[model samples]
Target: MTTERAYHHGDLRRAILAAALDVIAAEGPTALSLRDLARRAGVSHAAPAHHFKDRAGLLTAIAVEGYGLLAATLQKAESLRDLGLQYVRFAAAHPAHFQVMFRPELLRPDDPELLAARERTRNQLHTAVEGYSDDPAIGVMAAWSMAHGFATLLLSHNLDGLLDGRDPEEAFLSLTNEMFQSAKNPATG
Candidate 1:
């Protein structure tokens, strides 16, 4: 960061968080350092301290951003099946955020913004499964597990053979549709 700075240019917080995502995507979160983030953002090493206090703060920022993005993604998908497919797509597109967003042990969960964002994400998912009133909790939990597991497998390439050369979008939709079939009772619909 330019030591010669004014409020107009330093927007250090956004810069640091963007750089952290870039570094995490390329090298994983464990490789993240406040200094490395500063270097990546072309800021002086001390600049990040003004925004993130420490590495944990940086992580909390990442998690908060991840939750906000997740909430947006799930909100956009009009159906539970679509939301599940989008979850897989999100994991593929934003692996860095996806990697640590759900791992509660990695960051301080009590951070108010993080908690609020996370709750928003959960509510988005809950709304997606709203049609399954017959067994809402079980259906929501099962749907959540299926989507999370399939996305994890698909993004990780563990399901490479199962994909059987299908286009990724079609494959994601197919898997989610199949999962939806199992999660909700057909007689009710």
Candidate 2:
């Protein structure tokens, strides 16, 4: 009789998540599979399942992690504009996480950890917006829309020609400044 060796890793969960991120980055989230993650992690097929019951659970974990990272990034901003810049920077730096974080359909949104992480990030955004605008809600929405849209455009290559050799961050900052300036003086806009 042949005996299968026990799976032993320093941190199987983190390993699997790292593998999953690589897969998502290279092929989008739809192509991710626990089996493939295990293969990438060099573990047994069932190893990933032990940590995450299914794809939803795995994705939920990723969403939670993404939110935590975003919260940390936003918290470091010195101003509302800096917050927006950080948001775009985070999205660009963590494209895989950014892709998964906003797709509620792909995650178990009711997961407590996911909820907490999301709330933390949202609070960071709201606090920053509140400091800058008379209408906090509208400010929050506009800032999020601008940052998310800019990141999406940059990531999808839609801004390739429009950027015209400018650094993405500099272009985003300039665009943000222009929009805010226009908002301040609608007649000039």
lDDT (tens digit, per residue) of candidate 2 on 1-189: 111222353477887788889989999999999988877777778878888899999989998999988988888899888888999999999999999999989999789999999888888889888767789989889999999999999998999999999999999999989998888889843
Q: Model 1, 81-182: lDDT tens per residue?
A: 788877877777788889779778778879999989988988887777887656778877877887788777876778899878888778767766765576
Error of 1 at 185 (Å): 9.1
- Estimate candidate 1's alpha-carbon lDDT, on a 0 to 1 scale: 0.79
What candidate 2 gets wrong by more than 4 Å, as runs, is: 1-7
Q: Which pairs, if any, clash in model 1? A: 1-43, 1-44
By summed lDDT, the worst window of 10 consecutive residues in model 1 runs over: 1-10
**Candidate 2: pairs in clash:** none
